[model samples]
Target chain A: MIIAFTSKGTDWDSKMDPRFGRTDYILFYNEDTQELSHLDNREVADQAHGVGPKTAQKLFERGAQVLITGNGPGGNAAEALKQMELKIFVGAGEMTVREAYEAYQRGQLAQGA
Target chain B: MKLAIASGKGGTGKTTLAVNLALYAAATRRVALLDLDVEEPNSGIFLKGKLKREKQLFRAVPEWKKEACILCGKCSELCRFNAVLKLGKHILVMPELCHSCYACSELCPENALPMTQKSLGFLRHYEQDGLDFVESKMEIGVEMATPLIEQTLAYAEAEIAGADLQIRDCPPGTSCSVINATRDADFALLVTEPTPFGLHDLSLAVETMRHLDKPIAVAVNRVGIGNDDVFRYCEAEGIPVWASFPHDRRVAELYSRGETLYDKVDSIRTGMDAIHTQISSLGGGK
Candidate 1:
């Protein structure tokens, strides 16, 4: 499964960005390959509307099956992600991407409402 | 000819000029006064003695059919407002976020989506003493008024076809709602006071009107209350000063009591007559 984490930087040591739609970077980690890749999220920051759903579409297109972020998705974004069968886990709380992924592996992260 | 009474700053007497001009012009010409300030429509206050006809207005949102279910996500991808989304085992449609463009229903391949009407506001019509009036009253806490204002103009076009003059009392500030109200106007009369703040906002409103490429004029209200900055700005910009009214306690008191002072006050009548002459010079003689 590919886990997507909203991050403040490209590396795993960067803090988790609380914003789901307008986060600086999204770190994608593949569990099988143990490889990490990041995508810049600056494009959706200045949108006047529909930033959340657009961000969700980015993740859905990247084949991310799971999302770990500081907060849950908004109503529209949550609906879109849920339709794509993407599981979302919260409770990162300023942790780095690696720490959040490890916590998810340990089953310590709560499912986002 | 269509005339729009607008103001950059709030409480600059846009309604005062609009109601009085409608009353004055209705004496000799066929006039339809449209109150486009949906958020706070007060033109009906002064014209309340007339009999009014009211009608509800609605915007077309999208409705989905559950049985024709194909989770294609085409509607979601097409919608720019994010009003449509597919959730777990279902499609979610939020009507409030819908812009009512009908693109979703038109693009649905399965033909499962249909246009649904959602209540936007009310249109109140009044005809008393030869003046035809209509006001757009938006529902409380509703943010968008452009649709309602545009609907009001359409209603005016259909209901008052032979009218010689159409006067719109636009809301203050040069936002999208104001653009929607004044875009169809033949001439825009910007109402302002003689203050620095009034001049500042007047310049902004002028820039907006310039972008719309409409002929601009100025109406200075409560002339004695502030300095001559508004007049100076209008002169510098070469926009005509159509009329000016003095700051009188009696006029303010009459306005407070939902009365128009055009008939009772001589100076006010003269000012309105000057405005009428300017409006008539637009080449449509009545």
Candidate 2:
């Protein structure tokens, strides 16, 4: 499973970003390989419209099955992510990427908060 | 000549100036007053008359032919607006998100997507006090005002043949919609107040007009409230100061009751006429 965390920076030590669609960076952790990756989301952050749905599509394309962020997806973005069968969990802004993943593993992270 | 009345800040009295100018210009010329502030069109409030005609604006959306779709997700990839998305087994099309760019249908390999019309808003026409008034009203929750403004302008252009003046009351802010209003305008009347916030937005709007490279003038509304910073800046920029309206209690009282200040106030009416004469000297007169 590929779990994605919206982050303010590119590293695992960076705190989670509050914005889902306009987050600065997305940190992806692969449970199978125990590897981590990062994607810059700066392009969509500056868009005048459709940032939510466009970011959701980009996540789906990157094989993200779970999204952990401070805020939930927007209306159109939530619909698109739901249609892709991707799970969304909220309340991760204060946590680092590694802490968020550990919390997700323990089932302590909130869902759509 | 087409004159677009715009301001970077809201509540700078674009509609107030526009309606008054149209009313004043109608004395000797056929004037078309288009209220392009689709989000909150209030020109009709000032000018009351029987509705002459109304037309709904429509834009194309993609309709998929399920039998012919190959499930390749090519259409989704081609849509820049994210209006189309490819689910696991099918494609999801959000009609509201569509920009009617037709990229999905144009790029579909199987020709499964077809263009269909969707209602964007309404174009309303009213004949009020000898002026042809046209206003675009975007449907509730719809954000596509530029296209409807374009359509309304086209319709107004066709209807008002050999019109001596066309005044577009543009939406506030220097956004894409403002650009849509000022694209082909021969002149722009930038309405602003004398406050700091008003001058800040006025500078931004002036920059936008300079980029458009049209003749721009300034109208200072509610002149007594703030300092003369706006005038200094306009003078430094070499933009003409067309007219100024003093801040008066009676003007506010009249505006609250939907009354024309120009009709009741002699000074304002004369100021509006002076602005018209300036426009005429600038060769905007037809």
Candidate 3:
């Protein structure tokens, strides 16, 4: 299945690839399954004060299965994302892009896939 | 004097303080209110002003000419924002990712890249009940608010140059747009509540003001609800406390209806006067 992972908060410019850190949206495609996954880095948008519901909706429409973020599944955002049938993962700290993908594969995410 | 009212966190009464201050100042002095919170500008709603679209602002994005273009990836290499993409003979420009630094055009070897203006948004002006205001509204779906804020600041500088006082209502957080809004202001008035979250974000706001080298004072809103952490921080850091507005349901009711705080709270006038006096004494009004 296609899976998308997003690193949120603190810009993470030096740790992650600069291209990945600056992107507000990321799309991952699985060639074998012909599936697409999308993620929105809400941390940057949150830093800018607030994120609109449209951003969350866009990720849902793009077929995101799970949203890997640093913030927990609570507050208004949790309820909003829950309505879209997207699983929320929190406490994913400082893991490399590949490591995060591996964690997803191992079913070690905070939210079950 | 240009006083930028800001807070690192939202829901801290930044807009309330700014609108009241502007209204109070406008009573005697000609005051202009410029809302630099382009992302979510609510000052107009509070002031109940009818906004007129003054001018639309645009920024230049690189447009590569296919006829004269080589497949050289120099443009992409030079763009720090990664706005330029080289795909064989095609060079695509993502306007959202562009910072308008024009580094790509400066480094283009074939001179195939020409900067073209893309509409970011518009600068709107309005007047209501003797209060003049200006706001920058970014085009819907636009990610960047920095350019629009910069244009708004420029407009404020040019138009409100000779005004007795100018109160700028800024967006939340200490990002580039917020920085641009308050960079040239004479003083920054940081409004915050007394909660833990308020104190946490107040520190961020302090750091930002220090970075900008702007003289700052704190305004504690909803004084009785939260603890004394904000006051303690102010006393420890030697940052002056300009004013304090208590947690009152009357104030909330007026705020919900877009009435200026000075009109709602009689005590606010005294605080505003003191703030004005303090600012003028600091030569901000000159």
Best by DockQ: 2
- TM-score, B chain, candidate 3? 0.94
Report lDDT (Cα) of residue B92, candidate 2: 78
- Please give the fraction of native interface contacts (Cα pairs under 8 Å between A and B) kept by each candidate: 0.26, 0.30, 0.00
lDDT of each: 0.87, 0.86, 0.73
Tens digits of lDDT, candidate 3, B34-112: 9888988888777767765589899888887888888687886666554565533456666666788888887788888
- How do the residues B1-286 of candidate 1 rate in per-residue lDDT, one tens digit apiece? 9999998999999998999999998899989999999999999888854656789998888898988868888887788887776653467776767788888899999877799787888998989788899998999756679889999999999988878999999999999899999998999999999999999999999999999999999999999988998888888889999999999999988988989889988879999999999988877553
Tell me which residue pairs clash in candidate 1. none
Residue-wise C-alpha lDDT for candidate 2, range B158-240, written one tens digit per residue: 88776788999999999989998999999999999999999999999999999999789999999899899999999999999
Worst 10 residues of 1 chain A by lDDT: A74-83
lDDT of 3 by residue, A73-92 (tens): 33323333545556655445
Looking at model 2, the pairs that clash are none
Q: Per candidate, chain B TM-score?
A: 0.95, 0.96, 0.94
Candidate 1 error regions (>4 Å): A1-8, A12-21, A24-39, A56-113, B284-286
- DockQ of each candidate relative to the true complex: 0.28, 0.52, 0.05
Best by TM-score: 2
> Which of the two, 1 or 2, has more lDDT?
1
